[model samples]
Structures are given as structure tokens and as C-alpha cells.
Target: MTRSRKTTQPLVKICGLNTLTVVDAAVDAGADMIGFMFYARSRRAVTPDLAQALGEEVTGVTRVAIVVDATDAEIDAITATGVIDMIQVHGKEDPARVAELKARTGLPVMKALRVATKEDIREAEAFFGAADHLLFDAKAPKDMKGALPGGNGLTFDWTLLDGLKIDMPWMLSGGLTADNVAEAIRLTGAPGVDTSSGVEDKPGVKSPERIRAFLAAVKQTHLETAT
Candidate 1:
């Protein structure tokens, strides 16, 4: 489980890592979780062979496999490698599918809830038992060009999470950066946070320095909140 916002640093998940160098940087800099993209449409997508190698190098942190509306065959291929520690469904998967994925993979599942309003937030309650964790992310506008399932780098109003009453571990995501993550955490009271484009030098290209900076910012927030 992730630490509560009032107790210690939020669990930082650096998403879309396509290389081992950035993975090393994030883990070494104290990231609690690291994400690998499996959705074929994503620029950061990696083959099962490569993911296995990278997952092998992962140590002392959760190794998450991020997928978007993946097929059972595709999921089977990913889990077959026996490297992924968790599954993050970031598409239009329903609660049943979420539960199925958990049973099929035998790994904890985190269902992504895209939020643009209160109704979106309310939808998360349905997945309470289906998912091990819930992730609240910004919903991309329909007019946005070339938008994939996630990693759009957009942020919703943080106050929308205020007074949320879900009864499971959850994470805040979307448009989170080293600059604004502390404020986002303060507003949402999330126990964990996720970042993709915010720390990237470009799409699918992670910057080592930015990874370190983002983790440092999260640590600073924990220190301030603890005091």
C-alpha cells in the first residue's frame, strides 16, 4: 500500500519508461513504482521481449504494465513473460474486464478513471471491488488532435477530488510535473501520483535529470507536509 498523504511522501510512479537508463534513474531517485507501456498505439510501447529485460532490471519497486483496451491474447503475451508485477488498464474497460484481468494475470489491477467532472469521479465507485487501486486522470477533450488513451499531459481541476469517498488505494495522474505536483497532491490528498509526459524530453523519450527533479519535488512535499 502507498503511504497516506499526511504520513509520508506520495508514491511516485514514473510512467512510459522505454529504456533501462531512465528506469535506473527513477528507482535510484526513490520512485516507488515504474510503469512500462504495453499498448501498441503508444509511442512508448515495448515488445514483451524488451519488457522482460527491463522488468528484470527493476529492483525494490513495483513494475507496472500499462495497457489500453488490450485483448486477452495481448494480455496473455505480457503476463507470459512473468515479469510484470501489476496491470494498469487505461482505456474503456468496464469493471468486469478489470476483474477478469486481475484473475487472468494474478496481479493487482489499477483502473484508470478519466475525470472531467463530478460524474466522472462518481464512476470510480463502481470499480471499488473490481480494481485493487484507482487512478484519477484528466479527460482529453474530443477536439484534441492525435490523442491516445492517456499520456495526453492534461490536468483537470484538482479540487474535483476533494471529499471523494472511495474506500481503496488511489493515485492522481495527468499533467503532473515537478513544478505543480505538490499543489496537486495538496488539493487532491492522493496517496500516490503518476507522471508520463511531464518528465519526458519528448514523446517516449525520458530525461534523466527531469526524472530526478520530479522525485525530488515529491519528496519535498512530503517533508513539508510532515512538519
Candidate 2:
């Protein structure tokens, strides 16, 4: 299930990696993508120097830069580092901004939209041809105070995605782990899966063993589906 030459496999992404050891662990664990957070406010944020140091270790793995509602200057600065292969905008950027970034940076754009209601899910339809990848993570509840947009470790009801389909490739993130990843994929049939808080021992610390376990669970889910 890990290395499938036949069955179409899901890409596994390990986000919020800060240190070389953790980044190495993710790459060693066979993750398809490694994410580096640029939002300094988040506990998982890493300096550009740290990201470059860790990013240098990545060979076959795709390096992703995770940023918030970043301005064009910020995007320019991060993309200038020449380490990132993809840009993941985990913020309130609209479709126009996403398209602009894609035009300017020449990097594949991965837009993260927090879903709380069906309307929110439908809202991303406009970005279908505009974005390279679309991510659906749980939205910060309105009344809740100061919730980080992407890695809040919260999960929206999976049933919310029932029968949901989009022309764009998408992922199921938020509250995913080794324990429930199989169920999440079975429930939503996501083409890809991402994790940050789920594989962490704390806010930003990643566990290599956990990464392997989660990947195994996704494999298990695919097997169950193939039957």
C-alpha cells in the first residue's frame, strides 16, 4: 500500500515541521510534501533561515511554504528564498489574490479554505481553475477568540463533505491522526490528506512514528475501498 504502482495513491503531507530532525523524519517517513510555516504568530512558525536549513535536506520531497493572508511583498520575500516548490496560502486570500500570486511567483498555488458550512464549501468553486490544489480545513468558530486559521487541531463534522465534489484536487485536514485517518478518508474519500497538530507531540513537535502510522492508516483505508 505504501508504494503503489497500480492504485492511485493519496499524497501524504506533514505540516508544521520546525527542526532538521523532524523535517528529516518526515522525508524519511516517505511524505510526499513537507510544509514550513511562515506565520510568526503561530507556535509552529519557523524563520526563513531555519526553513532553508531544513529545506536543504529535502531531495525528492516537495517543499511547501505555508503563509497566512500574506501581502505581495511577503510572498515575494519567501519565494525569493528558492527553497519552496509550492505556495500554500492558509489565510483569507480571495481568488483574485490567489491568481495574482500564481502569475507573479510562478509557483503552484495551494489554497486552504476553512469550512464551517456548506456555503463555505461552495465558495471555493471559483478557484477551481485558479488554484493548483484546494485544502479544506476546519474554520475558526466566530465567537472563539484568536484561533489560528490552519492548525487549530479542530475538526469539522465529516458529514459536511458527504457527496461533495469539486473539479479541483483537494485534501481533508484538521484533527487527523493515526487513529482516525482511515475513518476520515473512508467518510470523505479525500484524494489527499494533510496533518500538522495530529502528528505532533505538542504544538509544533512532530513524531516520526506518528507519521508512519498515519500513512499506514491511509493505506488501510485505500485497501478497504478497493474491495
Candidate 3:
């Protein structure tokens, strides 16, 4: 089975953004999407008001609100801000929940599936019709301390996706950085890629230089792939 791509070039989403500076940097650097963490436990989390303020002036880049098993009120508050273009459910939300969120928020949903093995990938099929897009991320070890759902910066085996078939749009994520993203795309033939902790200086701090370097690397990869 062959995987499908949404565009000729791999789409880039820089997640876990909290400041306007990084937001501006991502947009200026030609990012396809920018994410705001709405989960309180995440070090990179931001309030709906803060996300709104940071995303208000942004254009051309899709703004995504990332949540982890959010309640109805929590989702309502985030969507009420009117700053998000997409909703990324990063927890244990099943296909039913994914569809419900789309109906409730009137926004496209991107369901994040944590992959530690082939079985996890197979389970993602449940969301095929429910979600608009799917994100494959590394599942942290159960014993790992201080691990968040999606931004733990751990990478999975890209080969796990080899020959796997899917009909909907999906993204490759987890520990992707300037150093390895090109190779990741080469291996998985992923149409889109997302990075959070990979571009950070520390747990929650994003470095402008690293962000620029990462984007430049992806751009170069796209250029090479085109030729």
C-alpha cells in the first residue's frame, strides 16, 4: 500500500508556540502551520487569551490549538477566542470524540496518534473518516518521567510506516529537528511534518535561530525533492 501526500512539498507545522516573536518567526520563515498548546500540564501551554493575542496579527499560516483530552468547556473556551483555524487533539480521544469535536467547534480536527509500535499505527485506522487529518507522534515510555503526550521530543521508527496505506491526510512528528527531518521525509514519504521540542532551546523555550535553521533545512529538503 502507498501513502498519499497533500502537496508536492512537505508541509511544516511548528508547534508549542507561546510568544509572538516565535509566531512571527515561523510565519516569516514560511511555516505552513503554527500550534498553540492549550494543555495546562505542558510546559509550553498557553491560555486562550494569550493564544488569541499572539495569533491575532498572523496571516497565511494556519493556527492550530493543541489540547489533551479537553473537556467541552475547555474546547469551547479555546474556540471562543476565534484564533484557531484547526484543532489538534493530542490525547486519548477516539474517533467518536474526534467527530464530536469537529461538530461542536465547527473546525477541522487533527487527531494525534501516539505510535510506539505497529499496533498503534493500525489503531489509527479508526479515525479515518472522523478526523480531517492525522498526526503520528512517538509514544513516550510508560516509566519516563515528566513526559507529555505529544511534545516529549522522542522519535519513533519511521520504517514502521513503510508500505502502510492510508486514505486521509497525515503528518509525521516526534523528535523531528533540522538534523534528521530530511531523512525522515525520505524514509516515510510523509506529506507533512511537525516539530515542537525539536526546535526548542529547553523544555519550553523556543530559539529563533534553531527555528530558522529547522525551516531552512525543510526548505532545502523540499527544493531537493522537487529537482
Candidate 4:
């Protein structure tokens, strides 16, 4: 079942967080969610132990674990730490797998769809009943070098999501930074926004200043919209 919206404000998620400094930065900046990558291949990946330590620095923000095609054992290990509040599947997990993960972990599961075209957005329907939430991220081209499942810092045409309709809460991700997040949110009217590489100094190194700036921009947009 889809989770109900928690607040009226647009959610801000700072993803790919690995260090306590970045974790604290995100929480202090009023991010609604903070994501710790569990996919080993990604530079942002962190062990469950490290994630737990970093999570300790968080208080109110939801903590999310991002995994790509993890096995049952891996999932068990990650959940065992009791650090994650939500699970985000970023690989080729089908609707059934999404449901299975929720049943197995008893945590809300979010399915991420990497989109390059409108047809990709339509794929959200397949996960409707299973995933509690959805995340739409940019899909890197086939020939793009060193592109992991996400955090490529590549963006799709926002126009593709102009008339997007889905059953559950969703977030707009990919290539989002402080300078453009306001525009992205205005264009797509996304209930939430997520960033990984966008707030990074390099591929997995998060910039605390960028993180604060991004959150500030989102807050400004919300304030403007409310008036």
C-alpha cells in the first residue's frame, strides 16, 4: 500500500550520504529524508555498520537505504543494523520483488524508475500496488561510461513528466542542484526532490555547503508557492 503524505511541504531528500558530517548537514538543513547507498559498486556505497554510525547523527529525518538488486542475505544484513527506515530498490526488481521486500522487511519500499522517455514513465503503473513510493530518475545512455544504476548526475527532459500521473507519492531526481531544483519542482510539481551527485564536490564526496544551499532553494520555492 502507498504511504500517505506526511507533510504539505515538498519533501527534500539528500541521497548518497556516507559521512557523519554530511548526514548532520542534511538533517540540520531540514531535509525530509536522508539516503545511505548500500550498492557496493557505487562510490557512495557504505557498509551497514558505517550507515548505522552515520544514522546515529540523524534525529527527525527519515533514513533510506538504497540497494540495487541485493540478495536476501544482503537485505537481511542491511536491515539487521536497524538504521534504515525505508528501502529503495534501484535495480531491475519487478513488482513482485518490491512486494516481497516489503513483506520480508516490514518496511516501506520505494521503486526507482530511470527514465529517458515517456514510455519509461508509464512503467510506474507496473509497480503501483507493490511499491509504497516511486522515484523517477534520469537514465544514462547505453554508451555512457561508468554509469551506475543512478547518481549519474544526468538529467532527462523535464517536459517528459509534464502530465505525469501516478498512484503513489513520488520524487523527482537526477542532475538536480540548488540552481535548478526550483525550476525542476516548478516544472514537474514533484511532491519531493532527491539529489546525490548534484550536491557532491565529486562523485561520492558530498559538499555540505551545496547540501545547505539546495535545501535553502527548495525552502524558498515552497515559501514562494505558499504566498
- Error of model 4, residue 12, in angstroms: 0.7
TM-score of each: 0.95, 0.92, 0.95, 0.96
Give a tens-digit lDDT track for model 2, residues 94-164.
89989999999999999998999988888888788899999999998888876898898889888989878
lDDT at 221 for candidate 2? 79
The parts of candidate 2 lying over 4 Å away from their true place are 1-8
Q: Please rank every candidate by lDDT, starting with the best.
A: 4, 3, 1, 2
Name the weakest run of 10 consecutive residues (lDDT summed) in model 2: 1-10
> 114-225 in candidate 4: lDDT tens per residue?
9999999999999988999999999999999888999999988999998888768999999999999999999999999999999999999999999999999999999998
> Tens-digit lDDT track for model 3 on 1-227?
11112322578999999987888777777788899999899899999999989878776678899999999999999999988999999988999999999999999999999999999999888998899999999999999998889899999999999997999889999999999999998899899999999999999999888898888998899899879
- The 0-to-1 C-alpha lDDT of every candidate, in the order given, reads 0.89, 0.85, 0.90, 0.91
List candidate 3 segments past 4 Å from native. 1-8
Best-matching candidate per lDDT: 4
The true-versus-predicted C-alpha distance at residue 8 of model 1, in Å, is 6.8
- Top-down TM-score ranking: 4, 3, 1, 2
